[model samples]
Target: MQDKLSKFEKAALLLLMLLAGIFGGLIRYFHLKYGFDALGLAVRGNRHAVILAALFALITLAFAVVIVLALTGRLFPKDAVAVGTIGAPTILLSALSALAAAVGTIVTLASAVKQLSVWGMLNGILFFAAAILTVPVVRKLSVRSDSASPIGTASLIIVFWSCFRLIEVYRTVSSTPSVSVYFYDLAALISLILMFFGCAGYLYGRSGAMRVYLTVAAYLFFGTVSLVGKGGLCLSALFSGAPVAMANVTDVCVYLYGFLFALAVIPTFFAPRRADPVAELIQAAAEPEESGKEEPPVL
Candidate 1:
């Protein structure tokens, strides 16, 4: 069982690394196609800001890789590090991603309000709150022995948000959606479906396969959507000679959320199973009591 679990962890880690590479490649391709500077100035229009953000993202990814390696015993001996130590990076990453999302939502909401788009403002606010709340839940999951509840809850929230965003984009593009935008929508829809099943499996504490499936699906779709959207924006900006919109910045932040969430949930998939208290309680209640023994007082 331990060996099988270790294999799964390694596989998941490899998939994540591959996805990360693909995402980075797409970003670079867009920059090159758009004739952006090394700092993505043409795309973001703020060299210093883009540079800083890019640096931060790189650091975060590196940290994530290190944590996963340590957890897998690739960076150290099998017993050298505690699981909690491996989990620390996940907590930090979650907090940082949540912070980024919150900031992006605020910036986006302000702009939307200025334009008097009620729906936009509402969506931004809703997503903002959801993103912020995810931090504490993820933090709790990291240190706690039993993570099913938090995992299920987070999965549901993310699925809802993804579906909401998908619908909003679909409505906006109903008239004449571009191929690239349609790809983005498809990615969001895929993520929603995967997360739904993932959440269900976690809540039920069954279907380990479903959990792994969701992890891969989430990571793949997350990378794909971000790449499609950002790549499209870069291409458009290139042709139009316009700077990247603040919306693109927001998208970057949103992309980080997916990456962080994937990292946060991976360990849970490999964790050893424990007895469910509720199940134990139900069994105890159902069992027949000894005829001669006095019944214990109910708590």
Candidate 2:
């Protein structure tokens, strides 16, 4: 049954990647000549969209291949569990996280340059550090022997980052509260909080971490809704003769983020419970010892 399920999952993943590739090709073909003006600069609209789609499709295909190989026990031979539990998903998530952080750093740096604000400079530096640190952290986590430590550290970092981002979103909303934006921010904030607690529980050897998969699923769902829904709204406005410019870069990032989250959730759902050495030791210690008395003839 497990083998059958694994086969099914691999087939589904391959199909998904194939579809992504086809969709990307179609979009590129249809929008080949599209162009637009942005900030007094002429931009190749179709080119950007085509590149984004192609890149997304390529990455998806690569990830699918990696997953298939891992599932087949061809990758990370000495650490199959780690590959399934953390390594594969970490590749996608960490790459996306780093990309997002890099974008944020660039934007913050630009803002600081324009405003000459010390705080903006500091914020930009922090973003840069996050972008640079993500790779090493993810690498360490991927190869770590114990899963709990890496997960706990990652979750804690996510919680803090999410809190900061949420605060920024709230401040923006307070000035001009849009329901859509607020909903997106709220979903993310809740997801991060749940993940934080879940990881914390797991680190402490509690079983409740298993339940956090639901929250992570919710997070991925809402994030998809927010990004795709916004894209849909942009299309609607465009068709309605509004001159709104959509950022393909952001769209690509969001797509990768959603895809990685979905994939990450899958392994988490199916991963076997790892044995806790401490818990086993305690159990053994608690067991009553057998008496060493000499046998009384009958024995």
| TM-score of each model, in listed order | 0.57, 0.49
On a 0 to 100 scale, what is the lDDT of residue 165 in model 2? Answer: 49
Lowest summed lDDT across 10 adjacent residues in model 2 is found at: 75-84
Model 1, CA-based lDDT: 0.54
lDDT string, candidate 1, 1-299, tens digits: 66566556555654765465455445544443453455433444644334434743673467456656664557543532112222555567777767766866876687688889887787787678767666665544323333466555664665676666667767865664223324444454555446544544545454443344334444543454454546566566657766435335555556556555655655544454445578899878767554447878999
In model 2, residue pairs whose N, Cα or C atoms come closer than 3 Å (at least 3 residues apart or on different chains), thus clashing, are: none
How many residue pairs clash in each candidate at the backbone level?
A: 0, 0
User: Each candidate's root-mean-square deviation in Å?
Assistant: 11.4, 11.3
Find the 10 residues in a row with the least total lDDT in model 1: 77-86
lDDT of each: 0.54, 0.48
TM-score of 2: 0.49
Q: Which candidate is the best by lDDT?
A: 1
TM-score of 1: 0.57
